[model samples]
Target: MRQVLFLTKIFLKNLFRQPSIVFSSIILPLVVLWSTWWVTADLPMTFELANAEQDVSSSMIDVHVVTGSLTAMAITAGLFGFIITNEYRKISDRLELVGYSPTTTGFAIFLSLFVTLSFSIVITVFLANFLAAPKDPLGLTLAIVLVSLIYVSLGNLVAIIIPKATEGTLILLIVAFIDLMVLTNPMGGGVYLESWTYYLPGFWPIQVALEASFLGNASVSTMVYPLIYFVLTVILILFVRNARARSTMSFLSGGN
Candidate 1:
């Protein structure tokens, strides 16, 4: 327990030192926020006023863009988190040689995911808040956290399967872009309207974020996706880890 915490702490502290990590945590979200605003500048802004006699409504397109932008940004943050995880893997490898166990590695990886991805999400929240003035701050934050952590776990799973950091990141980036653009498209009612698009990465998270932030609409069912993805990620990492442990044992025993 103590060791897991310590490892997690180390990863958190080290995250800020990396320029790439810092860029993802700070500049990426800002850029996403800016681009979303730039592209959707023509859209209407209809927010409620404090006056009891009035309620405001705006272009649904505007709302959709704003929500979709944040969802895209969340996907970007997760990709960046994957890059950081690759770096952390070097440290984990060394630790594994010295007496580390699966629990420590698993916990540490999760902590790293939460910490690194959370940094970017925080930036997104602050920036998006100013632009969209999200109605439910708590819901927005929770949605962002869920999306980021879920993607972080995903990044770890990719590391296990591909092993080559650069190749894996590249593949994940392409997939994320496709998933965000096609599945989470703002215009809606197009190719992505298929039932399967709902199952894609970033789909539910985006819906959760959009509903919570813009429409001020939410449901328990929305959260089900992120939780399901997280569980799948855990299972994947364990399978990969167990396979690696077996290989290590075999090597130690002279492949006999």
Candidate 2:
């Protein structure tokens, strides 16, 4: 535990030294959130009730806008996964030469990325509430945390497999585009995802956030899915570390 904490601190110090990573991971999300709010501020909100008049309440409109904005925020948070991956790629060899175990080092890297992503999510939620004043403040807060965790986990998984920084960034861009343009598009029936879509890490958090923001009650199961993803991600990271360690030992023995 102490070793993990020490490694986490080292990771954070490394993060702080890189100004661009800090900006990308922390500042960029707020910029996107602000842009979203600006664009949606004037749009009319229309809702079709089951058996009543189509009411156009401003508050209802605001809820829809905020949910979309929060989705953007979640995407931004997920992008940090790529940043961490790139950082690891740059330092992996150095750390390995220094005798640090891959598992400890990779986990430390992830912890730093998680902290920055969490801060960005908080900023996004605060801006959303300040600008629009969500009806259920607690629900909105919880939803943001859940959504952030899901995207961060997804980002971590992506980082683990992709070797090149540019490739990781490109992949993240494609993912963000598909998630917003196709999966979460209200016009394309975002509410009714196929069974396979449910397996997507981004799906549950966005669903929970949308439900909490607009419907006032998000399902408990939807909220639990992201937490499950985080656990799985940790497991995968540990597996990668163990694999790398074994490979190193084999190479060393053969060379000797």
Candidate 3:
């Protein structure tokens, strides 16, 4: 635990040293939220959500926009994942060479990500409430947090696969824009969900957020999609880590 904490501290200090990273991971999301709120505040847009109990419908514009924007926040988390993994790959490798285990290095990476991502999510949710209070504040926050973590896992995979910050960041942005904005947001022509779009990455998390924000509760069926995706991402990350460790050992042993 001490070693994990030590590495985590180092990771965080290095991360914060890059002003661009701090801006993108922390400040950028807040800017998006404020921009979204400002744009949707007076667009005469009201999303009609079916009530859980009755067959009635309620029109919610502000909360809907806020929740939609919350999903976009995951893009920043993904960027952070990509940056941290690729940028610190050498540092983590050296630590393992000295005395740290792979597990310790991986845990430190996760811890640093958790610290930054959680802070971003919390502040974003708090600002969302300040803009337009949702019926279930905690539910909204949890939904966003889960979605962001899922993207963090994705970012890790992308870093491993691409290993290039510019390309990885661009891919993440394009994916988020298409999946979250163009396909999920009502203003972006997703007022009604098509069956096929459900297979997309951001669909379920956006559903969870919508349910919590307007319906006041997210159902189990709605929450299951993101959970499944999150599990799959974790498995992929573990597999990659194991492969890297084995490859390193093989090289050190000189093909023995």
Candidate 4:
């Protein structure tokens, strides 16, 4: 427990010392959220129907717009692929040589990064709600947190595989584009299959938020999928850390 706390402290200290990293992780999200709200402030709430006689209500339309905006911002900020990749490049060898177990080190790094993500999301949501006053404030807040966690996990996984910072940033940009342009589009012209969007990690949070805002409270079942995704991410990260440790030990033992 003490070791974990020590590692966590060390990770945070190192994280905050880097001005660019701190700005990107914390300030970037707020900027994106504010810009979105500003640009969309004049838009009126209206929804189209394919063949139905009735149009969706203004409340529903507003909800859809807000949820979509939040999801996009969350994905952009929470996807810290470049940040983690840079950290690994700068410190992976030093960490390995310092006698710190890879699993412990990875967990500490993840936890510290998660804190920054959480802070950014929460602050942005607070500002958005305070200014515009979301109809379903509680639901929007919950959705923001869930979406942030899901994308952060995805970003972390990307970092593990992408060796270069530029490559990782490009990968995250592509992912964010796919998520927003393809998966989250309700117009049905996205790249993903119609049914496959439901399986995507960010889908449910956006869905639940829109439902709650536009159509009263959302179903409780909406929470289940993101939780499962979160658990699966943690497990996968642990496995990756353990695997890396084993490979390192083998190389050292073989004198290579």
Maximum-TM-score candidate: 3
lDDT per residue for candidate 4 within 28-143, as digits (tens), equals: 76666666556554434554322223444554334434655565555655456446645764475467667777776777777777776666776767765665466677877777
Pick the winner on TM-score between candidates 2 and 4: 4
Q: If the candidates were sorted by their lDDT against the true structure, best first, what order would they fall in?
A: 3, 1, 2, 4
What TM-score number comes out for model 3?
0.86
The 10-residue segment of model 1 with minimum total lDDT is 47-56
Question: Residue by residue across 5-85, what tens digits does model 3's lDDT show?
Answer: 998998888777877866877788888887777665454544533224433233345755555556557778888888888
Top-lDDT candidate index: 3
- Whole-model lDDT, model 1: 0.67
Q: Total clashing residue pairs per candidate?
A: 0, 0, 0, 0
State residue 207's C-alpha deviation in candidate 2, in Å. Answer: 1.7
Could you tell me the lDDT of residue 204 within candidate 4? 73
lDDT of 1 by residue, 1-256 (tens): 9998988888778776777766766677677666766675455544431112334466654565456445556566557656766766667767877888765877787776676666667777776666667777666776767766666677777776677777888877777666665556544435543667767767777667666766575567887877898788778787787778668767987998
Q: Which sections of candidate 3 miss by over 4 Å?
A: 41-64, 190-192
Model 2 lDDT tens row, 1-256: 5666787888888777878865786678777776666665364444322112333245434654565555666567567776676666657656765777777777777777778676777777788777667666666777777667656666766776776777777887677656654565442354436666666656666666655555666667767877887788778867876776667767877945
Selected candidate, larger TM-score, 1 vs 4 = 1
What's the TM-score of each model vs. the native? 0.83, 0.82, 0.86, 0.82
- Roughly what TM-score does model 1 have, to 2 decimal places? 0.83
What CA RMSD would candidate 3 show? Answer: 2.9
Worst 10 residues of 4 by lDDT: 47-56
